[model samples]
Target chain A: MVLLKLFWSFLQIGLLSFGGGMAALPLIQNQVVDLHGWITLKEYTDLITIAEMTPGPIGINAAAFVGVRIAGVPGSIIATVGCVLPPFLIVLLLVRLYLKYKNLSAVQGALSGIRPAVTGLIASAALTILILILWGENGFSTNLESLNFVAFILFAASLIVLRKWKPNPIFIILGSGIVGGAIYLLL
Target chain B: MEKRKSIYRKLFSSTFYISAFTFGGGYVIIPLMKKKFVEGLKWIEEDEMLNLIAIAQSSPGPIAVNTSVLIGYNVAGLVGALVSLWATILPPMITLSVISMFYSAFIKNAVISAIMKGMQAGVAAVITDAVLNLGSNVAKKKELISVLIMLIAFIMTFFLKVNVVLIILFGGLIGTLKVVLHERRNKGGGE
Candidate 1:
């Protein structure tokens, strides 16, 4: 029963959340943290942090991670299948429509509008992550000492490196891990 | 027939291996797919690959999976599509499952926790970079309507806290309406 519920919830997530992996964060957060009490907000953030560190789309990693925590290996498999099912089927159906009338101006127009909206969604995702990194629990950080200065610095440095170098993400991720470990050990 | 089977097998393995290395989202795989399918295999033309990408972007799934499906379907029909789809997602599913088994130990370690913090910061930066890249490409269009849609969508989500699905729907509606309105204007005045 729990496995079934997990599948259903993630299926809803896969269906509703559009734009990309980042845009799915809020919905996943609500379902896991508020609705089911499967994980706390802090844990949810940590899960995403780990998900980002891992090699996969953020959405897939989150589903797999959360599923395993709630229902073990079977739970993870079911949840992942659920998460992927909607998009897979939807895209498959759309492929027919797309290949047939891809040249239509109306289709082009709709796509143009969607492109910018997607950008906005991605921006908001970054904002959400930024706030979480800077403030511990929620956006309401009363104590300044609780703020993580090292993370803030790392965020800036990472951005600069990415813009200037355009290096492979694996290097950046691994480099951050080493730098973070050093910070933890030294400070 | 033997050659065809070999090609299909190559597609499956190539997609699987490329997918395993995909660290971020679908965006990261686009260039890799181009290299593998376009330059390496010489199976699809450059223009055709671009067309597939455009279609994949407009479709409703992860672009990586969508593109893989598109290319596979183009090459070898439904069976190929299924094969490519499975290949694309297999790595992440396997990796996540293994990580799940040992999650407790990793979570408890202070060193891992700190490393995650740094990685989180790195991820935040990467997301920001994606937004800027997408936004700048949109800016290159130099259309007032597109800019308006972009701003309105941004404000609606960031400030008004409107649901993302609704925003996307609204964008589509406005976009279609804009195109229709322009068409009517041209027909009524010039023609």
Candidate 2:
């Protein structure tokens, strides 16, 4: 029963979570934190960190993580399958539909409109994650006001380097992790 | 024949290795994929790769999975897609399985916490870059409407605690309605 519930919840997430991982965060937060109570808000924050650090799509990672938390290995399989199945099916169907209406003006217009909406969704998700990192649950205390400017600076520099030079993300991740750890230790 | 065989072998090996090693999911893989496919192998051109990314983004599956599938299909055939999908998923599945087995202990480690904090910053940077890059490409009207819808949805979710599914449904409805209304206006003007 629990496995079934897990499967259903993730299937909904997978089906609806268009765009990608960041877009999926709000939905996963609703399911994992608000609706089911499988994880707390803080744990959700931590899971986002873990998911970001781990490989794969954030949505899939969340499904696997939440599934495992709810049940176990079997739950993980169920949830992963549930999360993946919808998009696969949808895309397969879309492939055929796209072929048929490949030149339709309306299709083009709709897609054009959707393109920005997707961007907006992505931006909103980024904002949510930033808030979680900065404010925590209490919502904008003095501590958050301090705002870890150094981290933001590092983040901006990393962005420029990534865009211009295009370094290995693994190296960037590791390097940033070390810098963060050292900063924490120093503080 | 020998050249084709070598190409196939290269594609298989590269996809397999990337799938096995890639961590932190789709966004993380972008830089890696760009490195391997765009920079290293030159299997596909940069503009073509960007187009593929756009297609992947608009499509439904995980971006990494969709990208691997598309790139693989382009390089080899159905086999390439299968190989790439498997490769893309293999690392995370195996790693997550092991991690899940010991999740309790894993979550409590201070080192892990520190590392996670750092990774979060990196992830934030990556996400911000994605937004800016995509933002520039977005058609101007789409950008405005999209950002507005996004802001409304974000406020609703973060503040009012509305269900996300509902927000998506509303967004879709608004999107569809906008198109419909535009079409009607055009038709009325033409008439």
Candidate 3:
């Protein structure tokens, strides 16, 4: 029953998470954090951090991470299959049809519509993730006690670094982790 | 039949290496896929890869996995698709399993906890950067209707809290209408 639930929940995420990993963030967050109660909001954010550091698709990594935490190795397998199965089948079917009518204006037009919407979806997902990071459980508290200044600074610094140097992402991830660890030791 | 088997083997091995090694998700994996498939193997042409990318993005699922299935299908059919998909997901599944075994220790350690907290903020920023980068690129197309669609989709998701599925469907409807009207206008002018 547990395994089945893991598969079904991830399958929903897989089917609905259009665009890419970033776009999929909200759906995954909703399913695992809100619906299933498999993990807390903090744990989900931690999973996201690890997913970024790991190789392969973030969506796949996330599924495995959450699944293992919830059930075990078997859960990981089920969740990974659940996540991969939808797109695997759908894309195969799409390719078969798409190859036949690759030039149709109507098909092209629908795709054009999807293209811009995807950008918007990605932007919205970004905001949602930031909110999750900054706000946490409390809705809104302007007091410094509620805010995490260190995290906000890191967020802004990482953005600037990413835009300016365009360094390898793995390096940035590792670098930030190290800095974070150092800060903890000092505190 | 034998030739098909070799192609499958090659597909699995190549995808396995790429998926196992590439980090930072879909965008990073894509260029590596291009190099291997287009330049190295000559399995697909440059423009075809671009088209596949478009389909991969528009299709539901992870882009890396979607692209793998598309390329595998293109090369070796259904069996190949299965093989490539397996290869793409294998690394993460295996790695996460290992991580899970040590999950308690990792989470409990003070340094690890702090690092994760800090990294979450960094991850958030990186995501923002990606959003801006993708948005600006799409906006650069300078097509008014497409730009309007993008804005609408953003507003719908961000403010109205609309379900993503509906926004995508509505965008497609508008897209189809735009094309049909444009085609009619062209025909009427020509006649």
Output the number of the lDDT-best candidate: 3
| TM-score of predicted chain A against the true chain A, for each candidate | 0.64, 0.63, 0.60
Which candidate comes out best when scored by DockQ? 3
Model 1 residue B22 CA deviation (Å) reads: 6.8
- For residues A38-129, write the lDDT of model 1, one tens digit per residue: 88888787777666656677667877888888888888888877887787777777778866876799976776666666566556655766
lDDT against the true structure, per candidate, is 0.74, 0.67, 0.79
* Cα lDDT of model 3 by residue, A1-187, tens digit: 9999999999998998887787789999999999989989987887776776567777888788888888898899999999988998888877888789868989878777777876676677667667766776573467767766777777788889988986654455567667876886688
What is the per-residue lDDT of model 3 for residues B89-183, given as tens digits with 9 covering 90 to 100? Answer: 99989987777668657656887667766666766766677667667767787999888988998899889988676877777789899999999
Better of 2 and 3 by TM-score: 3
Ranking by TM-score: 1, 3, 2
Number of the top-ranking candidate, with TM-score as the measure: 1
Clashing pairs in 2: A54-B24, A55-B23, A55-B24, A55-B25, A56-B25, B19-B87
What is the RMSD of candidate 3? 5.9
Q: Which runs in model 3 stand beyond 4 Å of their true positions?
A: A1-79, A137-145, B1-64, B67-84
Give the docking tier of candidate 1. acceptable
What iRMS does model 2 reach?
5.0
Order the candidates by lDDT, highest first. 3, 1, 2
Model 1, which residues run further than 4 Å from truth? Answer: A1-79, A140-147, B1-84
